[model samples]
Target: MAKISTTLLAATALIALAGCAKKRPAVLPPAPAEQATEVAPSGSAGDVDPNGGPGSDADFRRSVQSNTVNFGVDVYDIDSTARAILDSQVEWLARYPQVRITVEGHCDERGTREYNLALGDRRANAAKNYLVARGVAASRISTISYGKERPLALGSDEEAYAQNRRAVTVIIGR
Candidate 1:
């Protein structure tokens, strides 16, 4: 029984390693099952367009093209596509000055928790700083690092890892 269990563990580890070795696209879409967008409490305010625009985060999410951005395996830098998305977010934020948001930094199940946490911070700040530089209020934005805690894809494959490594802008108090 001991030998059997050892063999099984070895096989599982080998399969996981093989999956990560496979080549994959640079940028893959977020997991189909994972809905990445989130909204904050609107308080007693009804779901009306207080900003004369999209009333709720849901409406705002639908109005824009994409809500989340992807990152490289261990990278947190924002690419061109990410920049465009942030531009849109800045526009939305500017429209809704009353809104506040939190940029969540995430990572794939690779690297140590400490390392990933630091990397995740860089990722979140990368996005937040871009927005602030573009004129979004720094006070309204905040950051958090969830380092591999919240994975969109539940596998050891590169594709799964790619999906997992991302930065999500969640509406905290809109």
Candidate 2:
């Protein structure tokens, strides 16, 4: 009876030890390699130009309306390059006869909220001015500044901050 009890205790310990062992993930067969990664449009991913040049006027219009332009880099103090990009953006706006746009200005998370708001306002105004200059009609182009309240990227690095500091062009109406 004593021998049988000892054997049972040893078997139980072995069972527990086996149960505690780390189980490995099931390995599946290797998948076939593809020649290239296919680009597909989703919520965050914008459409890519298959032709590889600046897309067509129609495509540009779609892109502008879809919030594709990032005019937020602080690298430009003169702001002419930003203006020129916006000029092109407004040109794209002309294609959609009834569509109106709202330029939402943003800033990097480096500054105070109030200061960032002011900076963002300036950025939006710059975009608005360019659109107005290009004959987009002042009424059609409204401006708003989110400041640093809404950052596109959360990281503290320059690359992330650069992307966060942008004025996005949004299509408000048909």
Output the number of the TM-score-best candidate: 1
Which residue segments of model 2 deviate by more than 4 Å?
1-81
Q: Rate the local accuracy (lDDT) of all candidates.
A: 0.78, 0.64
Query: Candidate 1 on 38-156: residue-level lDDT in tens?
Result: 33355544333433336446655866657788999778888999999988888877777767778888899999777888888899999999989999989989888878777889999
lDDT of 2 at 172: 46
How many clashes (backbone N, Cα, C below 3 Å) per candidate? 0, 2
TM accuracy, model 2: 0.57
Off by over 4 Å in 1: 1-53
All candidates: CA RMSD (Å): 9.8, 14.5
Q: How far is 136's C-alpha from truth in model 1 (Å)?
A: 0.5
Clashing pairs in 2: 72-165, 72-166
